[model samples]
Target: MRSCWRSAVATRSSSISRPRPIGDARWRRAELGAQPDLTAYRLFHGDAEGAPGLAIDRYAEVVVVHADSAAVLERWLPEIREDLRDFASAYVKVHPRRASRLTGQDMQQAAPAAPLWGLGVHDVEAIEGGVRYLVRPDAGLSVGLFLDMRDVRAWLRGNARGLSVLNLFAYTCSFGVSASLGGARRVLNLDLSRAYLEWGKHNYRLNRLTLDERDFVYGDAFDWLGRFARRGERFDLVIVDPPSFSSSPFSVTRDYPRLAEAAARVVAPTGILLAATNHAGTSDERFEAWLQNGLTRAGRHGQLAQRWHEPSADFPLAPGRTHPYLKVRALVLD
Candidate 1:
């Protein structure tokens, strides 16, 4: 994988004209196809794979092409669709540079409701490490599961046996599902959106796991963490994976330390805390500092157990970058 990254960097420096052709992406796809159980993965990482601002992901029989702008989508979509002809459907999603200024409706309008090529099927099941996840290709910005978090989910599935897991900011409860499947004694998912919690239930059902209504909690993560701390309820494993930026107090840059402190209160002594963020601007050193500050303020001593990054096969780091946009750290609290 390091060779892949270096080669990509070399290719970038060597060429100044047309971007790499779809054949390169096709080669990567063929390599990924060897894994029978996994059906969802990034086929092309635009930032590192010669196609800037353009990425392609495959979910089961569906292929999704993400372009940073309308022009990028228009430029690469046809060739990508042709290159991935084995897929049943193909869809395009445009991400404008000034998307932050656009309203929700405006963003939705940027993506087509129907497939740009092939069948009209939108809803599909994506399998990763033999776990089934419901994915809708035509659904607005995200398709239920975050492909970059695939390795994290797989790690949880292997390590959660007999542990009581608490998943904070559990969008669609993917972590909860993975933990439950790994034979965790109990798993509680807390999120701000009731609708997303319900969607999480659907994910649980897709895996044929029994769903307990009490396990799905809908509320602000900070508020719930406070309540859990007050009630003296602790978990053996706590997962904190929040969005990079949200309204007001949920901003990662400004509030992650507070969130980490609150989350630490509910982690049992000797338990593991897995904190993750996808903010590209925040370097790893600063993120670890934030975690240390929060743990020190909480009066808990801990050691860094492990660090996880995005799968390099699908998410190669850009030239000279030491880490990807996604950063995950595991701390063992004493």
Candidate 2:
């Protein structure tokens, strides 16, 4: 009996349980009738073309849809838009289903016939806080907000009280808002796109945060960080969230190392650093190794707090479904 119990315990411990609705169908039915809060409704499963990459986001009454798969592009279009209206207001924003040059032709071929479907292209939404702005995916290369970073934003809000916080690659400055709301006296948001920065400003205004609350700088992250170091400008809290690849001036391969060096300079003694890389090829071990090297070169050793793993709701790892590409890892520095 003792051996059997030990085996059972080990089995349970080894498995990762996913979040699911309770067994009571009535309770689930009740929830289905009501619109869920933002955090609660993180994913929308698509069935058109029977592909897995398509997803829809319901922002209050606004529906933002993305189709990243050729299969989905071919099958679901106007139908998907109508289905989303059940949750959204009246407007539905649709982005092109282009993935790579390889899929560009396919996407165009599978495109919907006319504008009668209420599908139209528009500029992405920008949100601002303190010194940062976030260009959300609603109108840009991808989804505007990285929802997985919700915890990191929460962490900033809790610890950034009265301190100056710096947000690097501040896509939409969601963290800046959280930190501002948390009581941070000043915040700085840095990004490369003027369009995204403008959108971010809108988000800040929507939240009723003031310009004095944050600063938005549009330029290369490395140049800004280096200049910040030279000017003796330091931040009490720094959040680094970078994309894996860039087609424009900033490439992670050519830039992350320099950014790390600049971060070391601007980081205060008691200040905290949050560094993240979302490259699917990058493993937790790789992130740790790179950070260790960066810290060593900076002649400063910081503690690695926790590793945050983000699993996509669109593609959950189930019986046969595979989610081998997406990776999100964060290292907290002290």
Candidate 3:
């Protein structure tokens, strides 16, 4: 009887010990095709990959594991650390489903201050397409940069030459930095958070780009857009990438059309406007309709120059899903 019980326990342990097949094939492909200077990317997209409630990202020497709950994070963290043994450090960040109910102390308790594996090195640099941006693995919710927008930044770098660019909702100004590197004549980064604007300046200095205080605007995007329109200021390239939901009066479902109309007003004739949303609930058809309505209201006619979705290789859609969460369209306004 004792021997049988021991065998049963062993069998269950063995079954649960194996690591989920995450980052194996993807890492191999990345290693083979990766540029020498690029170092940051999504190692595992949990919802689409084998791991349903967890995702992993690499930033230089550190690896961040994001989970939907503390229990899920703790359960799989050991296996993930073993699987990514080559990484210098690993940190786990739990995003509770009902975050609105939790207090600051509850969140702090959920995500411990210490690293799960190796030394606690929170701050690091993430290089993508040869442009460097600062990242903090231990930062709550989001580190300085959003890995999913890597392709969009790359596109801006390649196409922004000689254009005057305006980047709205510029968290840390990653898009502005990309535009600067791409040789844009001028780049204006607008955001509600002054601290983020300062961080953007640090990014500019990191790339050895010149600093002009006027270029970093600190105000609400809607107000600034109105002011720009009144002042007859226009941009050759306008980027509108607002958060899906924010404390401000912005809701992707309800306000996207209004936002689009405001953005279209400041686009120079024949200029390019890149509008994007990462709201999984909003369908592509609905999003496009909102853009069309906004354009029509603003009296601007345009053609969709390019439509970009999330990079499929790294961010594949989950099972039974037809489209990825991110949707971006570049319109050439006339």
> What local distance difference test score does each model get?
0.82, 0.54, 0.82
What is the alpha-carbon lDDT of model 3 when measured against the actual structure? 0.82
* Root-mean-square deviation of every model: 5.0, 10.2, 6.9
- TM-score of each model, paired residue for residue: 0.90, 0.69, 0.90
Please write out the lDDT profile of model 2 over residues 1-334, one tens digit for every residue.
1232233234334333632111111122233224222322233444322335555443333345556554554465654543332332222233442232325444344333222234342433322122233333223334456644655565666777898888888876677778887899888988887766766677677667887523988887778878988898888878777777654555555566566767877877767677877665665666666666666666666765554555333333434433333333334445
| TM-score-based ranking | 1, 3, 2
Give a tens-digit lDDT track for model 3, residues 223-283. 9999989999999999999988676767789998998999999999999989999998888
| Global Cα lDDT for candidate 2 | 0.54
Candidate 3 regions exceeding 4 Å error are 1-19, 23-34, 98-102
Candidate 1 vs candidate 3: the lDDT winner is 1
lDDT value, residue 147 of candidate 3:
81
Highest-lDDT candidate: 1
lDDT (10s digit) by residue, model 1, range 1-334:
2233344344444444644555465465555655778888887888887777888887887878888888887777666754566567888788765554568789677777788878787678888989999888887766788888888898889999999999998989999999999999999999888878888999999999989999998888888898999999999999999988554366788889998899899999999999999998889899998899899889887788878888888888877676678889989999
